[model samples]
Target: MNQTHLATLLAVLEEGSFDAAADVLGISPSAVSQRIKALESDIGRVLVRRSSPVVATESGEVLAQAARRMALLQAETDVALRRTIARVPLSIAINADSLATWFQPVFSEVAKWDNATLRLRIEDESRSMMLLRRGDCLGAITTEATAVQGCEVRHLGVLRYRAMASPALRDAYTDRTGTIDWAHMPTLRYGPNDKLQTNDLDGRLEGKPVNRRVSEIPSSEAFLEAARRGLGWALVAELQGRELVESGDLVLLDDIVSDVHLYWQYWRLESTMLHDLTAAVVTAAAEALD
Candidate 1:
């Protein structure tokens, strides 16, 4: 009935769990469950299936779409009345590596805006654009050049990655000639959806399986940490892994590098707040990303 309830429903659908949604909305799981129950009672229809991983019902999908539109419109209205309304928080999506490395400075730079706040959703670069397409975020830092529907794209910069491993791991896998066969080495992956490392290996090794002995660690920091501990070799962003390399925690496996060209994509809506936020992000990216 109210925006709070609608927002709660949207968060549950986006996060796929009551607890996760509650965390995002800064409410307790009980409060989120209560909101869903009340919403169902008012609508006379179950909006979500109560299960291990919550799923939105058909009715819930419709309402979720409505809520997204309403939220966007509300943002627009706030921007139009910027002098009257307090500064608005901008919701954004970005990859974990970028967030860990270059993205935080953008938020610091933008802190100069009297009324702006940033709500960040950290996803993989391959999937971040999907967040923008689904209305979960106003803008995204993504690897894809193609713009999502209703959005425009701007080239932010390229993120370069180097094949890296701990010295011990490298010594175990590499021959005296410094020649290495990737298929023989164990690999550390960012997540199930991550193909950055695999794709890099593909380009270098001609479609060979990347050391089937793979360890899947989902978090950016965790993945690097795993690599540092010699769990497996990993492809790491140059910016993120540089200090480790200098400290001898990681060694470059080969000169082979992967460069992912990143783009900023956002809805083509006419909103001053969105515009200002986009400018700040782009400026920051230019300074941070090579």
Candidate 2:
């Protein structure tokens, strides 16, 4: 297969359309279509589904990952030769809580590498690894410690979460016995994908279901703000909501806390760049996480 054709396929997948990819590559849409056709013909398999926004077929994903690895390798070579690389892609997946908290320092570390162009796909820790499986990202911060095939896992650290509520919300849920009513209080979740808040709370409540009204607020900061404003109670990470919990803006519920063990998973590429990034994440985890 031609290297340029492989890149063209990857570009179409990334840019989501042949015309957009053509603009990026400084070629006409016809040229992009021709390259994709040539690549498919050489591979003897259909690679992309010709939708309004093109999507890679399973076979095409393999080529896309190969292209990404090739680009990463070429960037490393350029770095060693003291040559300027236009953009060395560093696509990664991260959890929303981490993005709202310990992940910022990692961003700073990434900027220290001038050759890298960052791409982030945010999701729940439980689902972030899907990006790696799809060849969409080279690495991810995830809750699963089991290594993906052809990948390695590094245990970063546990991120602790405290169940917090506003003063008024807490009083409404507290009963005459000085014990809190767990079932009636309104609960807030980061999104439909997030089960952590409910999962931990259910376990702590002794297999009892938290049969409460749930509001789905997707953004990390906004979710915390909703909890602070007494809209509902939520699991608050220390890095994002510690101040509110400390300043009496948010009340810790039942003195209970949850620890989420985070792991860094990446393709087992023998690249120094991957190793450096892994080290940077581990170091930042030590500084920020429990």
Candidate 3:
């Protein structure tokens, strides 16, 4: 019915539960239930099936699409009425790994532009595209090659990471034949989804015993710091780890390297502010990341 009701229903469907939707919408579960009931009554259909986790019916999908369009239109209308032609906030969703490495330089470059504000949502690279589809963000730094609906993509550059350890640690573990048995050594890992170090180790071990003794360091900077402190070896981004490597704090683990290709994806709307921010990000990425 109203925008608020439509938004509440959409949130409930996306979040898959009334309680989760209420938490996101900053309202009570009872309020969310009432709004959804009102919406279902207005539509004259059971838009959502009530279960352990809510699911949108076919009718709910139609309403959800309409709700998304309405929200986008309202945003454009507000921008037009404010007479702020090129000053709209540029909302971006980016992965944490990039944010921890080269993305901050990109932000620094964009911040120099005075006309627009930057809003960032940090999630995993694999999940950033979902934020774009849900109208949660205007752009995303995604690993995805295929663009989301209503968005365009550009290849920014590749971020290269090197397997690294502390000099003392590397010397202690590596042998004369250059064959380091990781199974006997501790490892510093990013969260469970982090494949940079583990994948390489898996290949090197080749069905042999490899160290699964991992310390879960979620923050990128912390992950590198853990390696530097000789807590364990990790894959550190070239940009973030280069200075430490040069300072003799960290040592690259022989020739093992991982390169992650990154792309910038943004809505294809005709917004000059978004264009400026994109250009700035691309420029910075080119400089900071290969």
Candidate 4:
């Protein structure tokens, strides 16, 4: 396989268009298209779908991942040989809750490294595996225990969630018998991707879930803030909401807890940067997660 063609494929996928990729490569759009055509002819597979934002076909994904690994290894070699003063980019995906809690220490550790830099994609743990498959990120902190194809997986501990609400809101919705109004009380969610609050509610309620009053608060900080301000109740991460629960700012709705087991999935490559990062993540998770 031609290295130039592989690099062009990656550039098109990353930049989202042939023209954008051509500009980055300092070549004409026709030259970029010709290279892609030549590569497809050589491989006998349709590698790219030329849509509004160009996307990879199934076959393209395999080659794209190969190209990404080659680039990273080349970059690592360059840095190690002091051939260039460039920092090797270590791209990965992490969930919002983990980012707000245990993942903080990983940032501090990365800051001490001068030869590498981070390219983080903030995504939901349940859905980040797609990024890994597309080779958009080299690794991900995901809820999935099974490894993505061509990737290795390690079990990080579970992140526990507690359904919580403000004291005033809980009292306002509680009835005379002390049975909380699960059906009528408003609920907060991080986004459409978030299922923790809904799953918790459905398990506790009898028939027909709550009257579906939900407000979307996508940011981790704001999600907790909405619960604290009585906007709506939400399933908050234990590490993030423990102090609030202790301070009487938020109260648990029930004793039931939602435990999401997390895992680290990364390309099975022998690279020092990845090794150091995995060590840092495992160490932090051991201390923070149950």
What C-alpha root-mean-square deviation, in Å, does candidate 1 show against the real structure?
Answer: 4.1
Better of 3 and 4 by TM-score: 4
Instruction: Return the top candidate by TM-score.
Output: 2
List candidate 1 stretches off by more than 4 Å.
Answer: 1-8, 11-53, 57-66, 72-87, 203-205, 208-211
lDDT of 3 by residue, 54-152 (tens): 877778766775675565556556666775554445668886678877777766666675555667777767778877776667789988999988888
The list of candidate 3 runs beyond 4 A from truth reads 9-32, 42-73, 83-91, 106-119, 133-136, 209-211
Q: Give candidate 4's error at residue 261 in angstroms.
A: 1.2
Residue 48 CA displacement from its true place in model 4, Å: 1.8
Sorted by lDDT, highest first, which candidate order results?
A: 4, 2, 1, 3
Give the candidate number with the greatest lDDT: 4
Each model's lDDT: 0.82, 0.87, 0.79, 0.90
Q: Please identify which of the two predictions, 1 or 2, would achieve the higher TM-score against the true structure.
A: 2
In candidate 2, which residue pairs clash?
none
> Model 4: per-residue lDDT, tens digit, 84-131?
876777898998889999989998899988678888888999889999
What's the lDDT for residue 265 in model 1? 91
Clashing pairs in 4: none
RMSD of each: 4.1, 2.0, 4.2, 1.9
16 Cα displacement, candidate 2 (Å):
1.8
Minimum summed lDDT over a 10-residue window in model 4 is located at 203-212
Worst 10 residues of 1 by lDDT: 80-89
